[model samples]
Structure formats: structure tokens, C-alpha cells
Target: MASTTPTQIDQAPPVTSSGRSTGRAGDKIFAGLSKGSGILLLVIMASIAGFLTYRASIALSKNEGNFLTTFDWNASANPPVFGIAVLLFGTVVSSIIAMAIAVPIAVGIALFISHYAPRKLAAPIAYVVDLLAAVPSIIYGIWGALFLVPQLNGLNLWLDEYLGWTYVFDKTQVGVARSLFTVGILLAIMILPIVTSVSREVFLQVPRMNEEAALALGATRWEVIRMSVLPFGRSGVISASMLGLGRALGETMAVATVLSPSFLINGHILDPGGGTFAQNIAAKFDEANEFGRDALIASGLVLFLLTLLVNGAARLIIARRKDFSGANA
Candidate 1:
């Protein structure tokens, strides 16, 4: 072997300084890019808000009806009359129903996939759920319109007959089940895959040591989940449910297909005469004049604000429980 000499050692390039300078340049570039991306997102959001506000103000100024209390959307009338009372009610009620139905089931399925099911079964089920999540909203709308509406008729009749005293279940007409209640059920199905997929991933992130310790303490499977899995994944579940709720709020085609859109607020959800903000906007956008278009824009503004409020609340909840979430782990 050739012996190394002082000259050879001294001839090595001064790479450390070069490397440090390159690293610093890269860091600055990355930081600047990240900051720019965030600012761009904020700018986009602000632009949307500004546009919606300007158009909505124009419509509201000329609105002959009270924007909050009036239930009729007669934008083309001699004195234009329109309000979001019925739309707000339908949107909120349908989303409430979807959340009520989807969240628990999604959580349960998540737990089952994470802890209960055998790996072979769990893999296939999870794959199927991901596929469901990818399905187009138009497909769901078509399915709801063609199949679900007719299929729900018998259930609607039963609910009306047995639960009539509840008022909400009482249907004024016995025709097709094209009511907000049916739309709620459809939205529930549409959002199911999303909530379940998020929740399953969250559950899977639970630390192995936590589950082992619980089992070592003589906890049953259910107890292990209740104590270790659930508390850790609570924030994630809330986030997933909030995402699903956002979809329910802005859903256009599916609700339009399933709900019989009218401008009346029927406290009876089983009745076929209510509408959602998105549904009404879709139903009325084409023929609406400039003022009518502005009216629709006003309704869109309400929905945009509603979605932002829901997401903000979810973020707050998630922040409060950050330690329990698996992110840090």
C-alpha cells in the first residue's frame, strides 16, 4: 500500500465551508418558498371573500325580503323577495343528520379495522373504503335519484305512521321520499368513507406501548380501546367529522337530486318541500338575471362562512387536545 504524505493531505479541497454555505442557501430558499406558499393561500382566500362580499352586498341592498327571516326566494318578482331561512334550516338539519349517523359508525369501523379485525379482513375492507371515498359526487347523486329515493319510500311511510307525534317524522305527502330527511341519509352515505378512512388512520397511529400496557393491566379489548385508543384519536375523529360536515354543507348535485327543492321551511324533515343553500343555488343559477345571480352569490357567501366557522371550531378542538393526538408520538 502506498503511504500517504503531508502534501497529499494538505491538497484536500476546503469543502466544509462550501458545504455550509450551500446548506445555508438551501435553507433560506426553502424557508422563503414555504412562506410564499402560505401567503399565497391567504391571499387566495381573501380574494374569494372580498368578491363574495361585494356581490352579496349588492344583492342584499336590493333585497325586498328580510335576508334572515324571509322563506321565499322570489328574486324575479316585482319587488324581489328572498331569504336563507329555509335554505339554512335544510343545510343545518341535513348536516346534523349526516353527522349524527356517520360519526359513530365511522368511529366504530375505524376501531374494528385498527384493533378488532384480522389483518387479512382489515386490508380488504380498508381498500374498499378508500375506493368509496374516491367515488364521484355525481355518481352518488345519480344513485340517490334513481335508487335510494324509491327504496326509502317504505321506511318513510313507517316512520310517518309510527313517529308522527314527533312532528319531524310526519310526512305531509306520501309520494316519493324526496325530502330533506332522505337527502340527509344520502349525505350520510356520501361522507361515510371519508370519516371512516381518517378515523382508521388515526386509530392505527396509537402507540403500541399504550395498548400493551392497558392489556397488561388486565383491561378487556373494549376497555383497551376506550381508554387508550379513543382518547388519543378523539381529535382526529372530530376533524374527520368536520371534513364530512363540510362536504354535506357544500354538496350540490347529491342534494339537488335527492331533495325536492322548495322555498318553504317545513319543520317536518320527512316532508318533500325544503331546500339547501347549495341545492337552491344549483336549481336557480341558470335562468337567474344579474340581480338573481347576486342573490345566489349571497347564499353562497353564507355557506362559505359556515364552512369556515366549522373548520375553525375543529382546529380549536384539535389544538386543545394536541398532546393526546398521535402527531407528537
Candidate 2:
């Protein structure tokens, strides 16, 4: 074989100016596509915000009540009064309840699947969870309205009896559990699969070496998770929780179906009547006239803002703890 020399080395195949292994055309195409996709998403979001704002302004300009404080919505009335006070209360409270109930249980399920369950058990459970995530919102609404409502009366009664001192759990209404409390339980169920699936994937991504290091240090299985897995997956868990919360905040069909809609704020969550932004929009959109529709859009704008705030908060949390999120590992 010919011996290589300085001249031979210099005569080797010339690379493109960019010197990327994939060549300039491939790199440029991929970059353009990614940038374009991101731009398109932003454009769509902005369009929605603009449209909601435009319609909402029209509705607000003609409003007869304080947009923030008036308790009732009567878009069809002569003065056409409406406000989001009660709706905001219901939306925030119900979503908070959903997150409170779903997060711990979902995280536990994720941990069990990632760390404790055998592959045979985990695979089926994971598959079922994925299926649950795919189930339609309308179906969940129907299920909540029919099956879950009837079943939750006992739970409502129990909470009222024991937790009534807390005030929020006091069931003052004499009816089935078509209350914000019931809506929250239904929302918790709706968001559970989404949170669990994301958390499970995050826990599964824990570096094996890190886990082994914990074990080598005489850590128990739980201790290994506490020190190695939990820290690494904490950001991911927060992201998943925020994702679930976004859903809970905007859930329309299920809340409209299960929650007895009222225009007033009853502090007791277990009471029969309350309203949310999404539920109010969904329930009224069909029967609403042009102005009524705009009123609904105004409420939708509020829900949109709430969802954006939740996602922004999640991003901040993840950004703050990125070093411990296993990506560095």
C-alpha cells in the first residue's frame, strides 16, 4: 500500500464549507423546517389571542355590569350584563382541586411503574394509561354525568360530614353530586393519565449509573429513588403536572355536564351550583346571539390567559431546576 504523506493528506476528499457530516442542504432544510414550525405555532396562538380580544372588547364595550365583579351573566337581557367573578372562582378552585388530587396519585403510579413493577405488569398498565389519555372529552363528560355523578353522592356526604368544618366541603345542596367538587374529581380522572405517562417516562430516563451509585452507597430502593430518581425527574413531573392543569383549567364538556351551572359564588365547593370560564362558554355558545357569543369569547380569553400563565409558570420551574432534571446526567 502507498504510504500516506503530507501531500496525500492535503489531497483528501474536500468537505463542504459548512463541514457538517450531513451536508449543507440537509442541515439547512432541517433548520428551516424547525424554525418554520415554531413560527407557525406562534402565529396561530397570536391569531387566537387577537380574535378573542377583538370580540371580547366589542362585548365589553356594550356591557352593563362590572366585567370582573358582577356575579351574573345575562347577555340576552336588555342591558346585557355579565362578569367573570363567579366563573373565575369556580375555574381556579376546581382546577386547583384537580391538581391537588391528581398530582400525588399520578406521581405515585408513575414511580410504581418505573421502579417497582415488573415489566409484565408495567407494560400493560402503561398501555392502559396511554389508552386512557386518548379517550374523548365528550365520553368522559357522559361518564361523569351518568355514572360518576350518582356514585359521588356518598363521597360528597362523607366529605360534608367530616370535612365540613373546612367549609369548602360542606354540601348545602340537596341533589346528586353535580357540584364543583364532583367536577374536580372528574377533572382529576381526566388529567391523571397525561400526568402519569409523562412522569413515568421521566423516571424511566434516570441514569442507571446514578441509581447504581445510590445502591452502592447502601441506599434502600426507596432511598435510591429519593436521592437519584426524584431529583432527576422533578422538573419533568412539574411539566407533566402543568400539562394536566392546563387541561383541567380548560375542560369544557365534562365540567358543563357535571357541574350545576349558577351565576353566583358559593364558597362551599360541594354545593350544587357554580360556573367556570370554559363551562360557561360551552354551555352558552350555542344559544348565544352575536353579542352573547362575544361574551363567551371574553370568558374564553380569560381561560386562555389562565392556561398561558400555568404553562409559563411550569417553564420557569423547569428552567430553574434544569441542572437536576437528568438532561445534564
Write the residue-wise lDDT of candidate 1 on 231-291 in tens digits.
8888889989999998889999988877778888888888886889999999999999999
Model 2, runs deviating above 4 Å: 1-38, 326-329
- Per-residue error (Å), model 1, residue 208: 2.4
lDDT of 2 by residue, 9-28 (tens): 78987655455576668889
Q: What is the alpha-carbon lDDT of model 2 when measured against the actual structure?
A: 0.90
**All candidates: TM-score:** 0.89, 0.87
Q: C-alpha displacement of 152 in model 2, angstroms?
A: 0.9
Per-residue lDDT of 35 in model 1: 100
In candidate 1, the residue pairs with backbone N, CA or C atoms under 3 Å apart (3 or more residues apart, or in different chains) clash, namely none
lDDT of 2 at 122: 95
RMSD of each: 3.9, 5.2
Q: Which stretches of candidate 1 lie over 4 Å from their true place?
A: 1-33, 326-329
> How many residue pairs clash in all the candidates, one count each?
0, 0
